[model samples]
Target: MERRTAEDRGTGTDGDTAAAPLPGRAAVVIVGGGVLGASVAFHLAEAGVRGVLLLERDTPAAGSSGKPVGGVRAQFSDPLNIRIGRRSLEAWRAFGERPGADIGFAQVGYLFLLGDATERALFEEGVAAQNALGVPSRIIGPAEAAALCPYLDPDSIVAAAHCPTDGYALPREAVAGYLRAAARHGAAIRTHCPVTAIDIRDGALDAVRTPHGTVRTTTVICCAGAWSAEVGAMAGVRLPVTPLRRQIAFTGPLDTPPPRIPFTLDFASTAYFHNDGAGGLLLGMSDPRQQPGFGREFSREWLAPFREAAGRRAPALATLPVSHGWAGLYETTPDHNALIGEAADVPRFLYATGFSGHGFLQAPAVGELIRDLYLGREPFLDIGPLAASRFDGPAGEGNAGHTGARPEAHII
Candidate 1:
């Protein structure tokens, strides 16, 4: 995951596309073909927007979206995120009818294990907030938590937040679905095309340059995950995004299949696991020792700390043999939340990236938000707080009219 260029890999899930070839000019040019980008393309094209061009660095979902085990939940500690999560969940449920593709979505639910009283109290508040937002998440005792996932060590967990609506799905399938629908609606999706340069003249978008050719477009939406900072720079907009590597290991087919369970996480250690729905389990953790960078090579060394954390929470999973693993980039920002809003300085450039780890779940709703923003329609939610200018601090004369760092407050 470099600055401008995209990784040269996609899952090739994109089936036959009734899309167009590269055009000299387009009404809207989208950079990045991941789930978020593909969603935006579908929403915009479905809205009858013509001349829409989506350029992907590689195939769609070749980035982080193709790697991680998709966890969809609305049990956020904040209202904004919970709303986004809830809305996206509803959209994911209705995806098959409108998008005309099956995403393998399962509402197997999400369980967050809390280790201490402090964490318990925090989750109680989150559960209340989720309830208000129509998310049926409840704070339960360790006994109930262990009942849902038999592998859990009941003594290790003090409390848990369980949301039956939250679940896991296929990320690459969702991306391919969106791209296919977008293409059907007259959106040209060009793979292996990265936006090398963005030309802005007199504080307005001019064109987007790539290796294939340059396309003239006034509206450019950036869904580039880890490499959004460089795209922002080319357009004179500041998007402070960084890439951090996150890894996951898979236990190959086992003689005894794992019990059907929720996507469980040990909040204190950030350790998590889920049944692959195929005979084994997928295990992972946010390694605290990992330094932020573009290094995405999966390493067994991190498994040492992972096992320590997983062992403390679930004694049975600590000794599971890891058949294979992979490392992917988590596009992180200053606050570990997402960057979703139009740039005030460069109005033509709208961005939706830097989703610490919530991008997959929030993509569906964010697509509608971006589509509404581009169409000058009032979106269902007030996304003013998510403006990139929030990090700029004070709308001063020399600061290019940034909205000032008002703290988006989990506006993912």
Candidate 2:
């Protein structure tokens, strides 16, 4: 596996024209080369948009896109999220048909455990909503849940909502596919080109000034994730995107790994574990108390609670040593939901950040939505709820500073 770091620089014109000036003016310039940006780039190119450029400050997928747990599910509390995720899932299911390399996708499924009665009721409601949305999911008692996976401890789970149609997608593979397809469709992705400043001319995006050079673009789509607020600030737009830290760990291959196991989420502890499909397991837990910031340091202290919780949920996993662990940042918003649609104040500026943790699964739909906005086509999904104008109002004004909408513990 490639150890994704910030030093993997791409070919450049003497590191001065690193940002690569657009051919006069690009139809669209996407900031950030992560999964979201790649998806948008590919979608835009597929729409026959000429002169599409994707700018990356660091290595592609160096951010959350590379470290994503790849959990794709429709078990969201919000209807819009569910709908968007459902569309993306369908795209993944039909990935082979797309104009890109196969992402090695599989229907590993997802199992979200509920320990408390209140949470259990909420799970039931979510399951019902998912079913109504055509997601094959249902609530199951502890016995039934454990029956599906013999390794599961029946006594540990009070209830669980199982969704066989939802599972993980190889985010790295998917991003690679998008980049290749986008390039084939005439989209150029430039890396090591950090946008130091976004130049606005007469209340519109004029060009982006990068460390390498300036890129003239009419439409600037901010998909910088946690760093979106900083990018927005360049345009003098007070976007409320906050960078939050989320950590994850992986274990060595087991001697006798289970043939198949759903990606299980222990809601009681905000811990999640899943088989890595290579005789290994991946486990993670988020720290709710952790503040939002950009840091990738390892901490041994979080292991104790993680191990204790994992043992209670899957005793066999406790024996496996956590071979490696890494942390990344999630650009979150006040509502813990993504900020999509165009910025009312900035007509040409489209916001696609603040996905919190759901960005990976929603990438496909977001790509389609952004493509529609650029091509003058209808959006694939209803993204009215994720508009940037939501934070422009009085109530949203004060709440924009608040990033407490999503539980930090769910970062894993």
Q: Point to the candidate with the largest lDDT.
A: 1
**Clashing residue pairs in candidate 2 (N, C-alpha, C atoms within 3 angstroms):** 226-331
Tell me each candidate's RMSD, in Å, in order: 5.5, 4.2
* Candidate 2 lDDT, 5-97, residue by residue in tens: 321222211132244554556778899988899899989998888888888887678788988788887777645667888999998888878
Model 1 scores worst on lDDT over the 10 consecutive residues at: 3-12
Which 10-residue window of candidate 2 scores lowest in summed lDDT?
7-16
**Tens digit of per-residue lDDT, candidate 1, span 242-330:** 88899999999888999899999888788889998779999988887889898989899888987898889998899999999999988
Q: Per-residue lDDT for 102 in model 1?
A: 89
Candidate 2 at residue 15, lDDT?
Answer: 30
Work out the TM-score per prediction: 0.91, 0.90
For each candidate in the order shown, give its overall lDDT on alpha carbons.
0.83, 0.77
